[model samples]
Target: MSTWTEIGDRCWVRRYDEWDLNVGLVAGSDGAVVIDTRATAEQGSELLTHIRELTDVPVRWVVNTHAHFDHVVGNSVFTDATIYLHENAAAEEDLAGTTFSVAKVIDLGDRRVELLHLGNAHTSGDTVVVVPDADVFFVGDLVEESAPPSYGEDSFPLEWPDTIDRVIGMLSDTAKVVPGHGAVVDAEFVRDQAGDIGTVANTISGLHHAGTSLADALQHTEDWPWPLEQLQDAIKRGYGALGAPRRPTLPLLGPGSSA
Candidate 1:
């Protein structure tokens, strides 16, 4: 059980060793909001206990930054609170919660928490939770510090930079940025990450336009911002986004021509 670190006025982040996950909490006069529940109901229950350490305010809301299991599976623990998830994440399963398409403003009586879906970056359904008064942004998987942003089959490598750009637009100089799984960062850190993501996007575009085969793409570029192994999915998805030509299907060998 990791201890909670205060990043803003009443905003706190708890970092866990497993998956290096970070769970957030914001307290208001009347209620509190828990951001990104851990990986399971038991973890969520434990998170609630940690929240009690800071304030006994009732947790009235549960915001799932995306549909990732690490960020949302603990939703069941907050049985009384209204769980919120992006429509896309909700579509992945029969999630019992409120679904918002673009954005949703949650009022915790004394403070307002804004949930914004900037664009497709980490995932199509990635959500950024903003504690306006506290100048804190809980960007789930959009900005990572523990590791390079995870690029899976559902990731949007090309669109990620633009999505991060939108997040950058919302930050102030002293704003504390809590990643889904890392130490709290600032706007400058996010900008650097956005730059890296942009570089990868451009590299992928350049390779695709140059008629480079996906199989040989990695061999051509040696200076990737992230590890080559981690960027494999990025390259594959980037080429896919650009509609790069697929390998032609070879016809079966004729019996007469075969030895």
Candidate 2:
């Protein structure tokens, strides 16, 4: 079962049991914006039903935080709404939607939603939805609460901490942040998570610099911040990243800076 929690004025987060996913909604007098479509068409349809309980206005926009299967597979359900995906994420999935390389502003009749591509963290393309009026931010897997940050084959583990630092710099001290798969959180929570991710990234860097082989990497780190299972991908990806040219980091956005 899923439950809806109002995190800000007219901004709500719907939490689902599967994947512990958190879908966001920001309703306006003229229309609404759904943050993510869930994991499947049937799940997306159910999400649409849950949305109706908040407002009857048409869903004018759908923003996929990233191209992860769970966050975007259900996009087809929002047939009429204009879906927004980061250009990199668009390449991963052949979903028809408006693609933005850096940022885009969505006019939701009475509300303004800023879709920002902060930097590569969990995936090459991750969108941070900022509802300026409500001070509510829909940050996908960039900041996870249910578990440690996910570092998949596509994740930029080496740059994950820096990406998260940019997110922290852009948030207000009191902003209500709705993570992709967790309950609503505050800036402090985001800060702490950034630190943890930084530790993971730093550890990976140190191990790589110390000539630690990928297979023998885990053996060297006796004090693991995250579960060993979760760190496997992080180690692999981090090492891979360290071997390549680093991507430039995006400029830090001031608190409430939409662009």
- Per TM-score, the best of the predicted structures is 1
Candidate 1: which stretches are off by over 4 Å?
246-259
Question: Against the hidden reference, what TM-scores do the models get?
Answer: 0.91, 0.91
lDDT of 1 by residue, 41-127 (tens): 888788887788778899899998888889888888887799998998888766778999999999888889999999998888889
On lDDT, the leading prediction is 1
Candidate 2 lDDT over 1-259, as tens digits, reads: 6778888888889889988999999888778889999899999999998888767889989999999899988898999899999999999877679999999998877778999998889998999999998888899999888887787888988788888888888899989998888778899999998888888888888777777777787565565688878788888888777784344567899998786
Steric clash count of candidate 2: 0
lDDT score, candidate 2, position 48: 90
What are the lDDT figures for the candidates, one per model?
Answer: 0.88, 0.86
After the best TM-score superposition of candidate 1, give how far the Cα of residue 226 lies from its true spot, in angstroms: 1.1
CA shift at 137, candidate 1, in angstroms?
Answer: 0.7
**Candidate 1 root-mean-square deviation in Å:** 5.1
In model 2, the worst 10-residue window by lDDT is 241-250
